[model samples]
Target: MQKLKDRVAIITGGAQGIGAAYARAMAAEGARVAIADILDGTSLAKEIEAAGGRAMAVQVNVADETSVLAMAEAVNEHFGRIDILVNNAAVYASLQLKPFSEIDVAEWDKVMAVNVRGPFVCAKAVVPFMRSNGYGRIVNISSGTPFKGTPNLLHYVTSKGAILALSRALAREVGGDGICVNTLAPGLVLSEGVIQNTDMREKLTGPVLASRAIKRDQTPEDLIEPLLFLASDACAFMTGETLVVDGGSVMH
Candidate 1:
């Protein structure tokens, strides 16, 4: 069954990495996907359309309220309705792995702005349209590092922790409007960015694999099913929840 048939989904950071994977999977499942990102998503959107799916690429800076609101308006104008929002944009790929005290405050603030405020802005911008349609799905992308208190990336971890709380609180505020909100926390996924950075990949995935019950590399593809379930009508009754997809690393 096409779980997302006729749905319109906006995947922030959908130009590459795990967000791109989500855009593709959602498009395959019959959703009209909008690949919104700071980077150009034109090619990916064209790829989806070429493969018999409906998609559009929009440039957006999730951290900026004006940009987010403009993105929501553009998407709504094109698709006629907004059904799902996948908050996947963050400042992780270029993050410097440094000790807590060594990390600069400006860098910390940047991470917070993108990783935390970005989702908040996106939700606020998309809510009115979702309320108008009488249904919506919001899936915020978080990281498992916060749960494990992973070191060397304090700002990144801290920002992700806020995402879980954000998802919970936002869910409560929007549940009455028929909008279900949840968080999808993934482990060390060997996405395009990670795979391209061999040193970073080895440094992160080594600890993850050692702790994981399933001893294999986690990929962006591994997250597709959970994302789909959250975005589908099947999850209407579920909200304010966090699903940690980390191969049994953190059992909580």
Candidate 2:
């Protein structure tokens, strides 16, 4: 049998980039996927359908409880259950380069609302359903920046750190209920968000050859396996753990 046969999944930020890659991979793995983004998830849904997978699209704002709840409802109403949730929606603001002292408080809040609050809200809405089902997989997307000590990423990096903490505590609390929570911290995936900075791009690609055991440029494809491991039944025993998907970049 397929690993996730007949399962239902919801992935935020499912409209583009890494989130979209996860959506495609989940669908390919035999899960009925709900591609939920801040806007139309239709294109991803179309792709999944074209591939003969059961899929749906739900426009969602993960930071808003109301919007998150609506997304949850749509998943349950459409698929009758929620077996997995990939909390991948995040905002990579171009204005984050400003010095810490020059940062606007409102702008900081805006980033937090999406990067931190969004995942929290989405996870909260699914907990009741997951707990009731007594079986669920939750994959929270994190980044290497939390430990890499990268400069000029105070807003984005801080939220990823919080996600790691959230995944840990929630996994401990829910493990007995048959629900698993984990975070996948992807490093230098050549993401659309990172493409804005030429220096950052080279910075990401350079350290691997200079420092790691294996030197290779990281891409969205590099993360598919890690995502699948967390989302599939193969990872039942793992919880509260983080899988770093960098190309030997930030070795522990």
Q: Which is the leading candidate under TM-score?
A: 1
lDDT of 2 by residue, 42-99 (tens): 9779889998998999999887999899989889999999999999988762544545
lDDT assessment of candidate 2: 0.84
lDDT of 1 by residue, 110-217 (tens): 999999999999999999999998999999999898889999999999999999999999999999999999999999888887777766776887788999999999
Least well predicted 10-residue stretch by lDDT in candidate 1: 193-202
Let me know the TM-score candidate 1 reaches against the reference structure: 0.98
Task: Write down the TM-score of every candidate.
Answer: 0.98, 0.93
Top-scoring candidate (lDDT) = 1
Candidate 1 regions exceeding 4 Å error are: none
* Model 1 lDDT, full chain set: 0.94
RMSD of each candidate relative to the true structure: 0.8, 1.8
Steric collisions counted per model: 0, 0
